[model samples]
Target: MSRIRIGAGRVTAEIDEQGAELCSLRYGTEGQPGATELLWQAERAWPWHAPLLFPVIGRMNGDRLRHDGTYYAMPKHGFARDRRFTVARHDATTAVLALRDDAASRRLFPFPFRLTVGYAVEGSRLTVSYSVHNPGPGTLPASLGVHPGFRWPLPGATDKRGHTVLFERPEPAPVRRVEDVLLLPERHPTPVRGRTLRLDGALFTDGAVILEALNSSSLIYSAPGSPRMTLSWHGFQQLALWSPPEADLLCLEPWYGLPSPIGSDGEYAASPGQFHLAAGRSRTFGFGVEVSPAR
Candidate 1:
């Protein structure tokens, strides 16, 4: 997989052609003093830096999509993360990669669609944008998401347990969980107290904490003595926070869909949290991350 490097001011990003995944994001230039990497280096515990989720956000029932009375085997998070994208445009601080449905994609998704991902860096912020277009004659049922993992301890932080996620608004609503990769029907009390959620490994013993009723479009991930990062999104309806047990990374995910509910019939069109795109129409979603210096 080829990689493209883009930078502006103090931020730099490297994106891979395969999936157009962001492989690295740094806060300062190489060989400069106090340079820090904000993204997790795909270590032994997790093999992905950042993965783009398309067509579907999470696992489908029985890992199959039932459409028009036919079942197609679809992998968890769909196949966009594994497909090679064409570099549609590239410059010093911005790049766009595109993927159109081919014979291989149609076999799994059965839709004539085009997906494009764009990345741009300005100062200490990086913005990732997604666009999905339906070229087929029928409505396209799809979901999209981004899973980016940052360093657990973060730069300049002494302890990972001191990290916290501060939402822009109070999040007292209950959150959902996953079992066997399927969404559980029951809702659990949110761990957030007021607007803050303290980091803990035990919180992810089961799976990601799904915030289906998100009230805030932005949040700050911070730790004492460490640089803080603010994440803001638009056009996404849900959020998830996940980390592998004992791993040195934390993934902040913004999703437009949820996994198939337990005991679901695996129907594609009837699934929860999916947006239908009319023929020849397109929809766009985006999120931005801005890093601030530690106090």
Candidate 2:
């Protein structure tokens, strides 16, 4: 439950070590009324600031994972968020947290790996990076994603309708969804027309809006008179926007994989978006958030 603070100029952030999560971010110069909250308070239905998804992305059929020759029980989104991560290094502008595969983790995941997460604050932008290394002799198959929730209408805004998500390019692909957290094979036409989606809480009543094979790597969130945040990512294949029904926050997620498609074979290796890491090899995935005054 420890926290690390980092800042650059007028922008500052707080990272919680529990989930190695970014708990808070603020824009505006110090000692002024200009400071505004850019992150949600984890209120309402969900009480997490930012949860890192690893080993598994979404719900597995019956919460079971078939690997090698046995079936193991795995919870949705894996165990990374609930597990404690050790602080590898921390300073004024950057923090590095590390989690390693242990005996207990092996019983659940059956893989030997090391996960390192780093957070850096540069001016009005915060960069979050993840590196996973497969230390064992066998290949490691896993899914990774980032789920960070921002204030829907932002600070001082009264109406959620004033907020909107603007993509870097048009997103015309059919939007996929989940039924009880397991991804449904069918997809609906994207609601985004001309790269924009007007904020509406009702759209998330069932679950998240999943966009597979996105054409854009960046998206902008803005509301009238609020400091807008731009989310940019690389090495991610899917994007999901989610908000619990009536919740005041919207989660913009970058994912490398998705839940098992409908009627999956129940084999982990056959899962969609699962990354294979050769023994002793490492892979990195990252995303950044830049905050600025809305124009």
Candidate 3:
């Protein structure tokens, strides 16, 4: 397993080859230390730091996908996070990892594609970018997303609920929830009150809070006198917030796709939030996070 480190100013990040995942992000300088942890440590509650979801996001109904006339079984969130990525480039404050389709991937996706993930640090902000290239002669249908779990209480909150998420703008519309832990073809009332949603484990009883049509591209996770983190994304169509009520973490996810809908045609291409790319074409998506020092 290979891991690369990148840093600039007060921000430092560690990326792992196993998943091309950002395993650690620390803020502040050395000496008179005032270090802060911005990313969760993979634990038994959920053994993932920040897993990049590619080819597919969330689960396919019955773990199956129908393309053309045949049905193929696919694992939840596809397989990119479990595969090792080759380090294509690395420097003091930047790194890039690449994953290419092979026989193994073809069995699941049946398309020739390449996924490149880049990480860079500047001051207290870190930017993550993804590029998807369709190299085959046919259209490529796929999804991509970023799932990063931050410490629930942050750096100074007294309790998890003491922390809250502030949207850049108010979301007055109802949201959707997964049924029985599976995606449903309906929308439900959102738990957010105007622009702020307080953090609490009980709020996840029905799973993640999935919001679409977000008018804002930025979000703030913070608590009184605590280190505040801002997550900004562009070109993402949806967002999902989740964490087990019993766990001390909160996931702020930016997604281009969601789980396969229930009671629908099993065609993977028809899945909600799926993207299509013509042969030889490429698409790019990105998000960044800036963490301020603890108060």
lDDT values for all models = 0.92, 0.88, 0.87
- Of the two candidates 1 and 3, the one with more favorable TM-score, higher being better, is 1
**The best candidate in terms of TM-score:** 1
Q: Model 2 clash tally?
A: 0
Q: State every prediction's TM-score relative to the real structure.
A: 0.98, 0.96, 0.96
Could you give candidate 1's per-residue lDDT for residues 1-295 as a string of tens digits?
7999999787889999999999998887644766789999989989999999988878898899999999998999999999999999999999999999999998999988999999999999999999999997999999999999999999888768799999999999999999877889999999999999999999999989999999999999999888899999999999999999889999999999999998898579889999999999999999999989887
Which candidate ranks first by lDDT, i.e. highest? 1
Give the worst 10-residue stretch by lDDT in candidate 2: 30-39
**How does residue 278 of candidate 3 score in lDDT?**
98
TM-score of predicted structure 3: 0.96
- Sorting all predicted structures by lDDT, with the top scorer first, yields 1, 2, 3
Which is the winner by lDDT between candidate 1 and candidate 3?
1
Ranking by TM-score: 1, 2, 3
lDDT, model 1, position 64: 91
Model 1 residue runs over 4 Å out of place are 30-33
Error of 2 at 40 (Å): 1.4
Instruction: Please give, for residues 154-203, the per-residue lDDT of candidate 3 as tens digits.
Output: 87777876788999998777787786446876788777889999887888
